[model samples]
Target: MSSRPLEPKDPGLSFGGGARAVLPLTIAVAGFGISYGVLARSAGFPPLAAVVMSATTFAGSAQFASASILEGGGAVASAVTAAVLLNARYGPIGVTVAPVIEGGFWRRFLIAQLVVDESWAIAHRGDGRFDLRRLIGAGLVLYAAWTSSTAVGALGGEFLGDPNVLGLDAAFPALFLALLWPQLRNARAIAAALLGAGIASTLIPVAPPGVPIVAASVACLVGLRR
Candidate 1:
């Protein structure tokens, strides 16, 4: 027998399977994007500004934070600060996902640009058998959903009444709870969330708009380490 080691085999899924994956992702993203758009509009932002944010920033939480800062007469520095803090989670995400990406510089760059929490979660859920095609498909579909929603929101924002009156602001928390509920199978996770919430409540009165989120995230990290 030759001395060469055996190479692992890959299950190359069919195109139909890939489409099945992309469809649900697209629908979810589009719905989230719509909510984001309505919120941006209700916050008194121009439609163009929202679209630009969806295009450049690409992170929903960061974009919303930046928009709030901007609309509140905050300076550009404040917007950047809020966005950076809110989006700090993406850095860790990138670290873990770096190996999954395989491509030339430009392709990798595009993929990185599309690496939000949703895409990362979807990619990881693919059972370690994904390829460039799947990643690209998921990313592009999400991007399209986000951008399309922003556009729709922007268009509607101009002619529409206030979105906040309809409790649009609470959408984020609801989304978070929806995501968190499924992950609460363990005691540690629940404890961490409660600790983080306590920290946030204590800090909210004294801290700035985006600072409580940072503090809570830190608290969660520390709680996890304990």
Candidate 2:
């Protein structure tokens, strides 16, 4: 009898699958990153500093809120507060995927850093669990796109001159609607989305920058009743 050597395990999960699934969204994310870079640069952030923020912070809405506040002559403390409030949603998002992310402390921390909205949405298997492989794959590539595009916009943003002029500002709303479109199949979901949007629009005129968003998120509580 001949003994065969051990074969490497192939879990059959392709990290590339997640990367590919998110590829289309990656383009939109890049556009959004470029818009942010332009805004950050216009807000007086150096190109390097803007890129670093995108690389490290990796939270598009929060970064935009912070930069918008700064551009409006708001104080650093106010900007920080707005950013923090905008990112509070991540606390819940992180908890949802904490169990599937198996690793030691440092490994877990590193993986957790990759749990942005795009990766999180794409990686969820929709069965009350997540695909760790998909999460890591989608995250790494998205991170690269975000940081590099930020550099492009920050460095060359001067020539672009007002992201809105070129319709770059549309990237954000477009990206979000794309993401939201997939999840709006059910009536409950559709209602929740409409309610959230209505809440946000109503508050936008009267509330502070981040308050409208946070307030609109209360519509998610509607999901709990079912």
* Candidate whose TM-score is highest: 2
Give the Cα lDDT of each candidate. Answer: 0.64, 0.78
Q: TM-scores across all candidates?
A: 0.62, 0.75
Compute the lDDT for candidate 1.
0.64
Question: Number of the top candidate by lDDT?
Answer: 2
Residue pairs in clash, model 1: none
Candidate 1 structure quality by residue, lDDT tens digits, 1-226: 1112112332323223333455655655555566668777767777887888899889877887877676677898988887887777666567667786777999778788977765554344222233444455656777888898888877773455455566655654554555455555666767777877898899779876556655776644644364
Cα RMSD (angstroms) for every candidate in the order listed: 8.0, 7.7
Which segments of model 1 are wrong by more than 4 Å? Answer: 1-19, 38-45, 125-132, 157-226
The residue-by-residue lDDT of candidate 2 on 33-117, one tens digit each, is 8888989988999999999999889988899999988999999999999888778777777987999888799999999999988
Summed over model 1, clashes come to 0
